[model samples]
Target: MARRNEALLRWFRQTGWTQRELARAVTRLGQARGYNVAPDSSRVRRWLEGERPRQPVPELLAALFSERLGRPVGPEDLGLGSGAPPGGELGWDQRGLVTALQDFTRSDLMIKRRDVLGTTAALATGAVLENRLRGWLDPVRADAAPAASAGRIGTAEIAEIEAATRTFWTWDAKVGGGLYREAVVGQLKAMTDLLEHAYPEQIGRRLFRSTADLARLAGWMSHDVGLQGTAQRYFTFALHCAKRAGDQRLGVEVLSRMARQMVHVGKPREALSLVALARRGAGARIAEAEQAMLGTCEAWAWAALGDAGRVDRAVGTAQERFSRAVAGDAPSWLGYFDQAGLSGMAGLSYRTLAEGDPGLAGRAEPHIDAALRLRNRDAYARSNLFDLISLLGVRIVQGEHAEAERMVRRVLPVTGRISSTRTVDRIRPLARRARADAARSTDAARLAESLDGLLAV
Candidate 1:
């Protein structure tokens, strides 16, 4: 089954464009369509070789191809569709929830691209939103699980898998998601295949749960790689798997990710609604720590929307919950949500509201600083970099160019490696603000110039 139906690659071949030509054409189309796409021909080769496109580009690709060929080209053409090759598509609906979460932990590398080389694939943000809303409204249809019993994957396997995932997560946070996403994705795909083929009923159930975790990670890695639509699809699958496994808490967590993605793309209102839905589900089975983490996330959404009161209230709740959760070991799912994590989130929220209250600058600083203190580079690093960038923006806004320069200089190395478009988006505003508050000889001027140099190529 895996051998013949390379439908996606075939479709690309039919487009009458070489990798270089396709890239050039797409770049031209982006220019015409008013998107700031710094397209490179090498990325086209990655797309042809089964890598998914990142947010903004996937849709742009579809649109560009549609315009050139006079028809619609979907993510599938780029091999990002549901029917991707063996072990490729972590069909969350087929697996159970625990597996989905397990997949989430391990799937980071599968979706990442070479961001340091500027090879991150871009998914059309609108396409992802469209897909998520469509799936939420109409729901994706899941195939019935294969009739197989569970296998002998035991505590050792579970521990090994978890450790591996944590390592990648840490690496992804520190070095860049692009560095490890593919490896994670491929591993999950293989794991899914084995479980689907030979595991027993009892084992199958547990395996499915584990697979769900990997799938979630895969989705996240996809997002990191800039393949928002693919990530959305994977996340939706992970949610379905979680539901099948009867874990409402995990399902809600997936929803939170969806909402976070929305926030990344400037849809705070939609993000807030998604977070609200997550909160409602949190009432069902989440641990105290998870609950607090959700609240902190909610605060971020509210802050993004300029709702100071709600952000404050939500942050307070999050802090209280997090404090209570500290006495015991948190669930594996909630292990990633720690004091530093929540503090970083709080920092972002406060920074967002800093425009109205100068005091927030002080409040945001400590949290951001604490987050940076953590040696564990997981998602926390990528996320906190944004807070630092946000803080730099605030400094620029306050005519503190020297401070802004120092912050940006600190942030650049971190941002350079991560395969996150959102980080780039965050940096853009700071650069613009710096340029606006120009000082010819200041460090802020140098930082802005550096940004311009990077963008020029």
Candidate 2:
């Protein structure tokens, strides 16, 4: 005989439905969903005896329980299967994806799962990339009902969330991820709570779009702080939210950001594939600025892969497209991809190219300088700092040891104020290089000592 499912038994009892009545309910639910499922009282008995229901049935049961409980539910809640895929896995079905994000965000906020939050693992295989792309391409389902709850949500609340998201975004840009990670998480929790409340369909869509933007920003901040696993989960959830909002462009944006993360983590090939997926999703009708942003991302990936020709072509395309972009033509989320953002990415791409060909420093320096000059130091401190460090690295590679040392000294004091581990990691290489060259120059020796002191913090 099969073992009983105690969790299912408890939920069934709490629901107060006879096995036959539950069967009838499942049948009606399936009919309403246009699925041919017809579980009977006997089927319910088998489930009670721990026979796992198949795909659509488990999803339907979760939905039923969620409706009755006035909260989102999942297969794992009923002890039906191993817990849904971790939130970082972006290829799950709509309901499973939403439920996974809810659990992951809660766990991240509580700091209960350090291992999950701290990992830097990459899981962007071709199959996974294709799966996510297919999901993004799918039309939004029309049958999803507005969430049910005792309280009503309005557009004003959504406006507040949007304003808050913008505030956190600006803070992250200026103060770095370490300063705003907790605040972003708190905002996400509030948005998730709002999602649980009843609202009109139009308001619900707006809420989801805003939430998607916030989730993407949270992922970016997480990446900035070197919490790659946490970042991946946030990006996946942002994609889910964009899909729910029927915003393909936002989904494409999330994919681009994920591609950027992949490149940073040394998975350039995977990054290239992800960028391709984003382009495919955007198709021919995307705005020029969005096209330019995607092109720059592609250039970054190609530069990482050491494809100089492709990088040049891609960067040129990005620049040409950006020149055609008018103010307010792109979406609000794409606002960051203006001239300075493009210059920063171009500088990064050139820096990557210079790694294999030191003579390329001449080509890279102007872009890096332009990025620094174009960015507002107060509003975009972290990015400006990063560009400065990149330029320092390029100078060091060009054998301008004394100049590089002075630049490092000038920036050393600011690093203490910024909380990003990534910034420190980027600076460490220059310190090591300076140390290695100390025997050749007294300035190098002194700079190395100062850098060591800076790194000690």
Candidate 3:
């Protein structure tokens, strides 16, 4: 006999669904949404016996229950296990989101439960995406707590937080994310505590916006080190804070970041949807530089979709918008979308397309070269290494083995200094390709051996 799941049993009885019927309904729901879930009656029986289904099943169950109940339901409501921190649920109220963020930040800072917190599995599901979008579009409300009557918070404190966030951003750009993650988490923990206390309405809104900025930075840093699950949580928290601050622009930026993450995780179709949501959220008031950034992200999604025509049009639009952008006209967060950044995105789009159509190899090379030349070596070391790797791949495809070998040699030492798995992922494929063609050229063989030696450690 197994332990009883009272919560699940209650919901099951209320819905009047037999175990087999419920399993069939879940199967139909998943298949209708492009998932291959095929939970049988036995699986549903296990759930009633307190055996939590993996991942997506929990989310799928929640969505099913929510629809049947005519209200939002979550894994917690069904007593299902979740990878999210305490209070982490889709369709949470604003206070719930804040509480979840605080708990998550504390755990992250203490480095407890990292294994559960750092998983990327089940993150890109349709149900999760729809829930998050609905939450973002909902109206902002003031916290239930009254304003502080004694201790007061003001702009100076917010400025200091902003300045620190910028410093962390610079460190992330110069060094890899692993180096500064702890410090950012510490700052965020402190900020979360501050937000919990009372302050004037104006001060409270500014603090929320500032906190959102920090959260977004932390998410980006987590992404740099390839902690996609952790990054997604932070991005979600930032979206909540942005909404609480009544800053639609910041919310749009967070959505764009999430979209980029989706692209990196091989969900380009979902990524395109996120980009569209970000654009819609921005409405007609988006700044030129911000538009450029969104356009580049859109191009990346299109390239991933293998739509060469849409990729070309999107990249062109990005370049044009970026050209029209003037300094100080865009938001501070848009600082990273400079000429070098745009070139890198363009290079990435062309390189992805070139993988299928080698004729685009020539087009990719110049943009990649511009990114390498224009990027500041000290600040963008990791980015530059990725660019070099992309360039090497393009050269190999073009049969310029000598240049490819030279590029590998240049990037190998840089790779040692970086802690990004994504960088290694790109380089490993290039090395394998070179090794496969080693019989054709001595230089290729030498490069392959070198890469193997370097990567073995």
Write the residue-wise lDDT of candidate 1 on 97-160 in tens digits.
2243233323332232232322223333444444433333234345555435545576577668
lDDT against the true structure, each candidate: 0.62, 0.77, 0.76
User: Candidate 3: lDDT of 129?
Assistant: 69
Q: Please give the lDDT score for candidate 1.
A: 0.62
The true-versus-predicted C-alpha distance at residue 194 of model 2, in Å, is 2.5
lDDT of 2 at 152: 64
Candidate 1 weakest lDDT stretch, 10 residues: 110-119
Q: Where does model 3 exceed 4 Å of error?
A: 1-92, 112-119, 146-152, 439-441
Candidate 3 structure quality by residue, lDDT tens digits, 370-414: 999999989878788878878987987787777776776687788
Ranking by lDDT: 2, 3, 1
What's the TM-score of each model vs. the native?
Answer: 0.67, 0.78, 0.78
Q: Model 3 residue 218 lDDT?
A: 84
Those runs of model 1 whose alpha carbons end farther than 4 Å from true positions after fitting are 1-144, 148-159, 355-362, 373-384, 413-420, 439-447, 453-457
lDDT of 2 by residue, 1-457 (tens): 7678776776677668899988998999899989999999999999988787887787677666655543333455566643443222333454554555555555456443233333464343567556645667667765533345644667786788889889888888888888888788778877776676556668877888998998998899888877775687688789888888878799889999999988887888888887787778768767899989999899989988888899899999999999998887788878777788999999889888877788877777888889988988888888888898889889877888778778877788778888787787777777888898899988788878877877887
